[model samples]
Target: MVQTYTSPIRVYKTPFEFVMAAYEKRFPTCKMIPIFVGSEITSEITSEDKAVTVIERRCKLNVDAPYLLRKIAGVEFVYFIQKNTLDRRRRTLVIEAWNESFASRLVIRETCKYSVHPDNDDWTCFEQDAHLEIKSFFGFENAVEKLAIKQYMANIVKGKEVIDYYIQELIDEGVTHIPRFVPTGITEDSALDQSGIEDEITLSSLNHMALGATASSMTMDKRIHRDSLYKLDADYIHRCLGDLDPVEESRIVELKQWLQEHHKEKIPSDAHLLRFLRARGFNVEKGREMLCRSLIWRKQHQIDRLLKSWHPPDVLKTFFPGGWMDGYDDGGRPVFVLRLGNLDVKGVLRSIGVDGMLKLAITICEEGLVKCEEATRVQQRPVSYWACIFDLEGLSMRHLWRPGLKVLYRIIEVFEANYPETMGRVFLVRCPRVFPILWTLVSPFIDENTRKKFIIYGGEDHQQPEGGLTEYLDGKSIPKFLGGDAECGFPEGGIIPRSHYLPDDLAEMESGIDSISINSESLYQSVSLVKDSYHEVPVIVHDAGTVITYDFDVCKGDCIFTVLFTTSAVKIPSSTPPASPALQTSISVIHPDLKLKEVIRPIPCSDGSSEQGTHVADKAGTYILQWKGVDPTASTAVHSQFSFDFGLTSPPKCKVMYHYDILTQDEFRGSLSSVQSFSSLSMA
Candidate 1:
C-alpha cells in the first residue's frame, strides 16, 4: 500500500531568507525519502499523481517536483515559501521549520567541513597572521591604506602645483600676500593614528591639510605663519607710535593698546598708515605734527640767534639815513632837462624822495629842449642859418613830441609858437637815437613837404648837402665861394638865351646872387605865333621882333604863341625891351599854309548856363571862331585836324598838363602852374 503526504513548509520575511530556510529545513529529509522509497517510490508515484515514501511518512509529489527541488537546495525554506507558496499556513510552517533546521544544519556542516579540511583552518589562521604582519610592518591595515598614503603624497604634490599657479596669478593681478615655506614631506605622525586619527590631531591635521590644499589649489602661499606672529610689546608698540607724527602717533598708540588688550589679530603697518595719511592730503613726508614741531623749533632758534646778534641803532641807520639828499640841487626853480639816455625816470623818481620829480620828468620828456646857445648862434647868421635852426628844432621838438593825433594839433601849436621863423626856412633835423622816435611820433602830423625834407635828410644812404643842419650842429662853417676867372665871358647873339656861362662861373661866384643877362634878340628869337589871328593881337618872333600890329582887320582870326627860354642861368632877368611889331607879319609870311581869319567878340553865356560834367563837347566837327579877345578882329579857330591828328583837344586837357609837369617843366613852375604851353620853336 502507498501513503500520500505533502512536504513540510516555512515562512520568512524576505524572499531570499525564506527560500534559503525552506530548503535547509526540507532538503535533507527529502533526500532521505529517495533512499527510502527507491524502487517502491517510482511504483507508487505516477507521472501526474505520485507518492514518495520518506522517513515514516508518504509524500505526494508532482512530476516537476524534481526540477523545483533542485532549485530549492541551499535556499532558505522560508524564502522559498515566501517566493513560491500562496498558502499562509504553509508559508508559516516553512519559515518556522527553516529557522530550526538552519541552525542544526549549519552546526553539522561546520563540523563536517572542519573535519574534512583541518589544514584549510590552519591556512585561514595563517592568512590572519599574515595580515597582522603587514599591518605591523607598514603601520597600515591593508594595501589600500598604504595606497592612501601615496595618494596623500600625490595630493600634496598636486596642491603645490595649484599653489604655484595661484600665486603666479595673484602676482599678475598685483595682490600682495605673505610667503610661506613649502613642506617637503609629512614631518610627524601626530596628524594620523593607527585606527584613524585622534580628535585634536584630526582637527589640526584637517585644518593644515585643508589650508595646504586650498592654498595649493589656488596657487597661493599662506599669509600667516608662526614666524610672522609677533608678541605684543609695549616698547615696540611705543616705537611704532613714535614713527608716526605726534597727533597720529597718539591715536595709533591708543589703538595699539586696545588691540593688545583685546588680543586682536590684525594691525596696520607703518607703510599702510602713511598711505592713509597721504590719501587724506596730510603731509606724510615730514608728517603733519612733526612738521609743526620742526617749524616751531626753527622759529625759536631763529629768535634766539636774532636776540644774540641784533643791534638796533645799526639796523635803523641802514634803513633810514638822516638826510638822503645831501648834495642835490635845490631852492632854484626846477628846470627838467631830458638827458640823452633811456632811463626809467618814473621808477627813479619813485626810488628818490623828490616831491614832483615824476611830473617834471614826464613834462620834460614830452616838451623837448632847444639849447639857447645853439639857437642864438643859428639866428645870428641870416642866410639859411635860420632854416637850419628851424630844421633842428623841428627834429628835436615837433617830430619828437607829437606822439598821436589827439596831441598832434596841440604839439603843432606849441612848435609854431616856439619856432615862428621855421615857416621861412628849409628845416632839417637829424639825430640817430631820437630820430626814430621823432619819425614815428610826428610822421602823421606834418605836411608831405616836411616829410619829404625828413626823408631827404635821414633816409638810408642819403647824400647830405655841404652845409646842412648836421654840419651846423657839429660846429662846421658854410663853404665860401671863390671869384670867377677872366675867361668866363657871357655868350653873344643867339635865338634863345645861351646862359652856359652862368653854369661855368657858378662855383666861382663870391656873391650869392644867382643871376644872368641875355641880349634882346636872344630872348625874343624863339617866340612864334599860331596863324589865322587878328591885326591888333601881336605874336613874338624868332627874329628879335613881335607881331604887335597884325592884319586881322583885313585878314581872319586870333592867334596863339609860345615863348621859350633855357633856365640854366642862376638868376633870371626880370625885364626885357619890347620886340618890333614886324614879327607878326613875318610869322604870317613864314607860315603861308595857315589861313588867315578875322577875330570877333566871344559871346559870353549867362551866369549859370554852363554846368560841370564828365563830357565836354557834343559835336565831332570843327567849331567856328570864338574867343574872349580884347580886339574885335581876334578870333580863335579850331581845326578838326588839330583834334584828331594831334589828340591834344581832348576832354582831359588837365591830365596832359600834369603829366608834362614832372617831365619837362621847372620844379617851382610845375608845382605852381595850371596852364601848359607847347612850343614848336622850342623843339628846334
Candidate 2:
C-alpha cells in the first residue's frame, strides 16, 4: 500500500536570505539530527552570474528498525539520493530526495521547498510532502511500512527545530544578516565577501516594513476569526485549539480545508472538527466518515436548535441527579456533578423510556459545549473540555438494570461518535462494590484516551485534603453533601415517586414537546403474548459463518425464549409469520421422523428481566426466535423479590421488546460475556 503525507505551510519569522544561510550550515551532518549520518556531494553547478545553483548528494541515514528486521534486510544505514535546486534570483529553493536502498521492494520519496512569503518579502515560508510505498518487505510489509512512516514523520517534526537551532548559532556568531543575491555578473565568491556588511536602510523604510508586517499579521488573525476562514495560523491554532504536533497540525488543516471546499455553509468550529479527528486517531478518512454521519444526524434531529427550542420535562428536572455548577475546576474548566448512585434508573426509564433518556444525555453534551466556550472566553485560554464528578455513594444493582444500561450504551455511542475528547477529567468518587459491574460493561466502548482521564476512588477518600477532589477542584465548589460547606444548587435526587411513571400514551405525548424520541424510529419491536401462545421472528441466513445476536427485555410476565433452525424445505416468510400451530406447540415444523435442531435451549425469562446471547449459524437456513408465554406460577423464582413491584395475579398479556443484528464472522469482534458479568438475570 502506498501512503502520502503533506505538511502545512510553516512560516519562519526571518528573512529568506538569512534563513537560507542558516539552512546551508546544516549540510554534511548536524548534531541536532543524529539519525542524519552524513551527506557527500556528487555533483555541483552554479550559473555564471551566481544567481542559481544546483547540487546532487548521496545521503546516509541510520535506520531505526528492529535488529531482526535489520539483519534480515542486511543493512544498518539506508541511503538516499538528494538533488537541490536553489534560485537566488527568485528567492526559492526546492529539494527532492528518493531512497537508494531496496529501490525495487520499497520506495520513499520526499520534497521540501523554501521560498519568500507571498505577503512579506522579509519572511520565509516552508512546506514539505512525501510518499511511501512498500511493495514487499521480507514478509514484514506492514511493520516496515509503519516504521518508515513513523521515522519519516519524526524527522519532519524535527526539521524546523534543527533549522532554528542553527539559525540561533549563526546569530550568536554575529552572522545575523546575509545580503540577498543581485545579478551583477560577478562570481559567487566575490559576492560572498561583501555579504558580511549590512545593507543601508532609511528609518522611514524600516518603520514602514515593520508596520506592514504587523498589519498583515493582524489581518490574518482577523481572517481566522471571520466566517470566511483561510489558512490556519500557528498562533491561532495554539490559542484556540491547543498544541498539536506537525503531523496533527497538518491533519487538522487538511480536514478543515476539505470541509471548507465541500461544506462551505455549515462548517463546524475547528474545536468540533478536532474532537472528531482525535476520536478517529487522526485518520482523515475515518474522521471524515464519522464527522459526516454526525452532521447528518444533527440535521435530521435539528440538534443545532435544541438548546433554544427544547425544554426538559418536569420529571427529569426534579429527578435527574446531574447538572452544571456555577464554579470552575482548578484548571478553569466548567464543572458538572452527577449523583449517579442516587439516580433511579428504573424510574426514569419508566417515566420517559429509552429515547427520552438519550435526549437528556445529548442535551447535557450540547450544554457542555456551550459552557466550554464560555469558560474559554472568560478564562482567556483554550477550554475545549469540562470536568465531571460522579458521586456513586448509593450505587447498587438497580443502576445496572438492562434497559437502563442499554440507554447508557446508546448515549455513549452518540457521545463518542460526535463529542469525543470533551471530557477534561472524571472523578468517580465513593464507588461501591457494584461499581465495577457498570464500569465493566461500559469501559470497552469508551475511547482509551478518554478513559485515561478518569480518576477512581473506591470510598470516602475523595473528601481527604490530599490526593482527592480538592486537588482538581476548588474547595468552595465542593458540594455540601460531600462534606463541604457550599450548598450544591442541583437537586438532591432520591427514589422517584411511583406517580411520576408515565404511561406509553402519555410519554409519547410528552415526547412530542421535543423531537427526540428515538423509539419512534427504533429498530427494536415489541410484541404482546397471550397465555399458551408464542411470538416468533424468522431470520434468513445465507452464509454459514454468520453470527446472530439477540437482546430482549421481558417487560411484563414470565415467558420461555428459544432459538431454532430448520433443515426441511419449508418456505420462510420475510416478515414475522403469525404464531402457527407447529411453532406454538412443537417449536419447529420439521418432519416428525427428523430431529429438531435447537440452536439455543429454551430459557425461562421472568418479569422485569433481560437476556442477550449470540449463536453462530452452522449452515445457511431459516433461524427463528420464538418466545412462548409461560405460567408464571411454574417458576418458583418468579415469586421472589426478583419480580420487583409486580402483583401475584396472573397478567392477561406478557410483553417483550427485542432487537437482533447479524454480523459476518469477520465483523464479530468480541463476546459480550467478556465485558458483562451477567449471562442472564432478573432483578427485583
Candidate 3:
C-alpha cells in the first residue's frame, strides 16, 4: 500500500529570485535544523550561456527513531539524493528528492517546486508533495508509516520560518536584490555588461538547468470569478482549508465545464466545487451529475431560503439534545455536539412529523455555513469546515427504534447530499457494542471518504494514555462532562417528556406537509378481488373556479389515480362517522346513483416519483378522488414472490403514497410564488 500527502502552498512575500537565494542557504549545514546533518554537492551542470543550471547533491539526515530500531536496521545514518533544476527564462525551480538508504525495503519520494506567483510575480509560491510506500518492513509497516507521517508533519510547519531567517540574513548583508535573468548570448567581453553585473548571472547557460520549461499546467477560467460568492484563485482552496492537491485544480476545471453545460445558473466557487469533487474522489463526471441533481432539488424545495425561514419546534429546540456550541474546538472551526442517547427520536417524530424534522436539520446546516465564514475571519485563513462530537453515553437499541429508522435514513440522505465536506473531525466516545450493528446498516449509504473520518472509542479507550478525544481537541476546551474542565451548560439528555407532544393535526400544519408513510401496514395490502376495485374520498366545492391541487408520491408500487366529480350533490347523515383521511379511499364506488362528471388521470408514477398538479373547477358539486387497481390477468391476488416476467399479474399489494389540499380563489392569487407557504390538507 502507498500513502501520499500534499501540503498547502507556502507563500513568501519576496520575489522568486530572492526566495531562491533564501532556500539555497538551507544546504551544507544548519544549526537551526538538527536532523539535517549536512549536504555536499555531488554534481553541477549549467547551460552554455548560464540560462539553466542542474545540481545534484547527497544529503545526510539523522532519523528520529529509537536507538533500538537504529541498531536493528544496522544503520547509523540515512542518506537522500537531491536534484534541483533552475530555469532562468521560465522563472521556475523544480526539486526532486528521494531516500537512498532503504531503497529496497522502503520507497520514499518527495517533490517541491518554487515558482513565480502567477498573480503577483513579486511573490513566490512553494508547493510540496510526498509519496511513501512500504513493501516490506519486518511486520512493522504500520508503525513505520505512522512515525514517518508524524515527523513529516512536524518538519513542514517550520519550513517557512527557516526561509524567513535566511531572507533577513541576506537583507542584513545588503544583497537584497538579484537581477532577473535575461537571455544574452555569450558576452564578447566576458565582463561587466550594460547592467554593470557579471555574465554568470545571465540566462545564456541556463539550458543546462533542465527545469522542465513547459510551464505549470495550472489554469483558471475567467468565468469562474463572476459567479462566485468569494474570489477564487488557483490556490483558493488551499488557502481556505490549508490542504489541497494539484489534481483537484484539474478536477475543478472539468466540473466547471460540466456545470456550464448542464446548469448555467449555479455559480462556481473553488470552495464549492472542491467539496463535490472531494466527495466523489475527484471523479469529475460523477461529481457534476450529483451536484446538478442537488441544485435542481434545492430550487424545487427553496432550500436557499432555509436559513432565513426555518424554525424548529419548541420541543425540538429545547429537548433534542443537539446544538452547536457558542465557541469553537480550539481550531477556528465551529463545534457541534449531539447527545445521541438523550434524543427522543421516536417522540420527536411523533410530535413534529418528518417534514418538520427535515426543516430543523436544514436550520442546523445553514447555520453551519455561517459559522464557517465567521471562523475564516477569526482564523485569518479559510476555515470552511467544522467539527462534531458524538456522545453515546446513554445510547441503546431503543434509540434506533424501527418506527423512526426510516425517518433517520431520510435525514441522513438529505444531509449527505446537500452538505458535502462540512465535517472536519467526528469524535464518538463510549459507543456501545450494539452500535456497529446499526452502523453496518447505515454505513453503505454514507460516502466512503466521509466514513473514513469517523473515529470511535469504547471502554477505557475514552481517556488516559489513549487521549481519545484529546487527540483532536484541546484538553483546555474539552467540555466538563467529557472529563475536561470546560462547562458545556447543556442538558443531561434523556427521554423527552411525552406530555409535551403536539397534536398530530397541529404538527402537520406547522410543517406545511401532511406526509403518510407507505410502509407495509395500510397503503400496502393484499388485494384478492376478481374485478376492478375503487377507493374514493369525497370532496365538496363551495364555489366555482377554485384551484384544486393534488400531490402524491409512489413509495412502493404503482396504482392508477383519477379525480371523479359527482354530478349530483348528496349530503351525509349526521350520525355517520367522518372518514379516516389517511386511508379515506374506502368509500363504496359510485355506480347508478351519480354520474362520473370528470376523469383527471395523470401519467403513471414510477418508484420514488412525485406527481403534483392543479385544476380549475368550473362547476360546484361533490367530487371523489379515486385510487384503483384492476389488472385483467387473474381472479386471485397476484403472487408476492419475486419474478422478472412482465406478462404476469401485478404484485398482490400495490403501495400508493398520496396527500392533497384545496385552495380557494383568493388563496390561489399568489400560489405561484407562495406554494410552500400554503397549509396542507386538514386531517378534519
Q: Could you tally the backbone clashes for each prediction?
A: 54, 0, 17
Query: Worst 10-residue stretch by lDDT in candidate 3?
Result: 675-684
lDDT of 2 by residue, 1-684 (tens): 987776767789899989898888888997888988999999999999787899999999998899999999999999999999998866789999999999999999999999887678788988787889999989999999879878977887788898899889999999877877866765655654543232222333454576675575576445545523535766567777888876787788778878876774688888898889988989989998999988988998888998888788888889888888888888888888999998998788778776678778888999999998888778777888999988988987667655567667778888887788899998888876666657767889888899989888876778777787787787777787776556777777888876788875675455334434434325557777767777776778898989997878787788889997876444444453454444444334434553457889989888866776779998998788889887675457655536654557655678888888898976665444433433222111
TM-score for every candidate vs. truth?
0.14, 0.64, 0.46
Ranked by TM-score from best down, the candidates are 2, 3, 1
Candidate 1 total steric clashes? 54
Greater TM-score among 1 and 3 belongs to 3
lDDT of residue 101 for candidate 3: 88
How high is the lDDT of residue 109 in model 1? 9
List candidate 2 segments past 4 Å from native: 35-37, 40-54, 62-77, 87-90, 117-121, 140-143, 179-250, 257-265, 313-319, 330-332, 342-356, 373-384, 394-405, 432-453, 494-504, 508-684
Candidate 1, residues 333-438: lDDT per residue as tens digits?
1111111222222122222212122222223222221222233234331111122211121222222211112233433533432222222223232233334433
Displacement of residue 410 (Cα, Å) in model 2 is 2.5
Over 1-684, each residue of candidate 3 has an lDDT whose tens digit, in order, gives: 676765556678898889888888898987778999999999999998686899999999997987877888889889999999997756689999999988999999999888877678689887777889999876778878977877677667667778989999999999979877755754533422533353333432342343322221111233334333232344556666456444454456556655655565756455667777778887777888778777877788877888877776677757787777766765667888887867877677767766767777777788888888888867778876788888776765566544355566767788798789988777776665556545655777877777877777664465754556666666655676777666665666656665776664564454335332213122222222112444455678878977786655444445567787865775444354433232323344324556676558535544334455666788888777666644423333553354356758544434444555577967654344333322221001
Clashing pairs in 2: none
